[model samples]
Target: MVNQNNSAQSVEKTPSVDDKNLMNIAQYLKGVQQSHKRSIPPLDQWHPKHCGKMDLTVKANGEWWHEGQLIKRQALLDLFSSVLWKEEGKFYLKTPVEQIEIEVEDEPLLVSQVDQVDIDGKLYLQLTTTNQDVVVVDDQHPIFMRDYAGERRPYVHVRFGINALIQRHVFYHLVELGELDETEQGKAILVLKSGDLLLQLDS
Candidate 1:
């Protein structure tokens, strides 16, 4: 009887908020990694039971928040990002058995790193997301800008129907590497990729 009582107490003991968050994230990463090894799980097709909303939120400035506290751990953030997806104009982390919604003030991703390389006598831009996933700025994937509050905000396609908002410093680097040119149709563009990709600039 005493052993049963002790076991019950152990099970009943609640973990701290931070501990709970970590456990959930760790479990999610484990499942996601296994599924990713084969291929991206068909999160869109899986009609999983809707889990309750998580307290996770991504701010406009690319900061992540959990339970109203800033999530400063990059590793945790990266793990959470691996399962991100968008549908019906909303972002979600769709695990195998549950789909949880997270708040996103802006785009769900941030391109925090940038690099330029010479490919066949032309420079190619490589952009890295917060999750360390890299995408080349090429013909199929091009950089774009939008006017936000009278300022041009830079963005680029991340992957699988998602886009990343370029960080301020990364955008500055792109500006330095970008060259102005004209297309055959006389549209002004910024030539950032080699051979083909000429990003159209809004006049």
Candidate 2:
């Protein structure tokens, strides 16, 4: 009887591990989806703001300006590295180390390559690419730079640079993979064809 009870307990514990693993997999997939969405910026509309010009050689000494209002360069770089934009051409940052690279085709795309394992101890497919671009603009405007006696403190503005073409590409890929169900609105949820969902969870 004791042996039988021990066996039952072991079986129960097995599923608990599996459940925990599934939850973890779900969270990882969710994170990847969110990151992909964030890398692209909206470029469908444009608004203009007024900016002041100043001489770089002269410092705005005795000028009463707000402190801690300036955006740090590292912050801007971090923003740009995560988000996609287009200035001269298509640009984006690859994850892990956030290496910036540009897509050269007529239609640019951002590729995210990830390695995932399955619950069955087998490897599976989770590799995919998304279309995106990086928008680069000169921060010559004094409003972007504090203490604007103009020291060539060029600021790089980062934002989404998505268009109809890229949007269609995303839509089509999801549809082609049969991952698109009418269940969600404004977003695509992919059903991965490879890799055990449970293994991915543990990973």
Candidate 3:
């Protein structure tokens, strides 16, 4: 139930974006992360009137940097990853009281590994992110391809509005597991099937 500042005009009253402001926001988010260890913060419920853009950036390889300096603390990266909010194609670190925009060179997360699981005669694909987040590929968390550097690369929805780019080697392994299938238009495609769910790797 966190809320923004007192007035909608609070944007004019908020502190300017600076190194000190970044540090303050990071510390505040750290405390919030600790309180929500068993679950992600209620970011969708929190509303901030003005979200200012900042120099924080997540590199394509999933390295987080603040002002051109790498964030070496895995704990901070994990903490910030939890509050990542997306709006209108931009990224931000959000909290109940504040929202700070950040740059993302690619997807906010990276898929480091994947596994196939079978239960009750049903098959599923499980993905693990660099931050240790695990999600099963299903209707809600499906894989889709996007044009990256002139090539189509696969990405999977991780959580909230965040997505993880599948590492190249891992993506190759997924292609190996796929079988040839035909589209409704009778065009051949590569696909991976798990139980009743089917994903086209090549479109």
- TM-scores of all models? 0.75, 0.18, 0.80
Model 1 root-mean-square deviation: 5.3
Per-residue alpha-carbon lDDT of candidate 3 for residues 1-203, written as tens digits (9 for 90 to 100): 11355457555654435565576767887665545453567888989865578888898878888877898987767777878888888898887778888899998998889899996788888888877778889898998888877877889997777899999898877877788788788876779876688888665
Give the candidate number with the greatest TM-score: 3
> Model 3 off-target regions past 4 Å?
1-17, 34-38, 180-188
Q: Give lDDT for model 1.
A: 0.73
- Candidate 2, lDDT over the whole model: 0.30
Using lDDT, rank the candidates from best to worst. 3, 1, 2
Task: Quantify all predictions' global Cα lDDT against the true fold.
Answer: 0.73, 0.30, 0.79
What would the per-residue lDDT of candidate 2 be over residues 42-125, giving only the tens digit for each residue?
Answer: 322322221121111101221111121332343232333333334445443333322233332222323222233354575443
Native-to-model Cα distance after best TM-score fit, residue 182 in candidate 1, in Å? 9.8
**How many residue pairs clash in each candidate at the backbone level?**
0, 13, 0
- Candidate 1's TM-score reads 0.75
| lDDT for position 169 in model 2 | 44
Rate residue 188 of model 1 by lDDT.
63
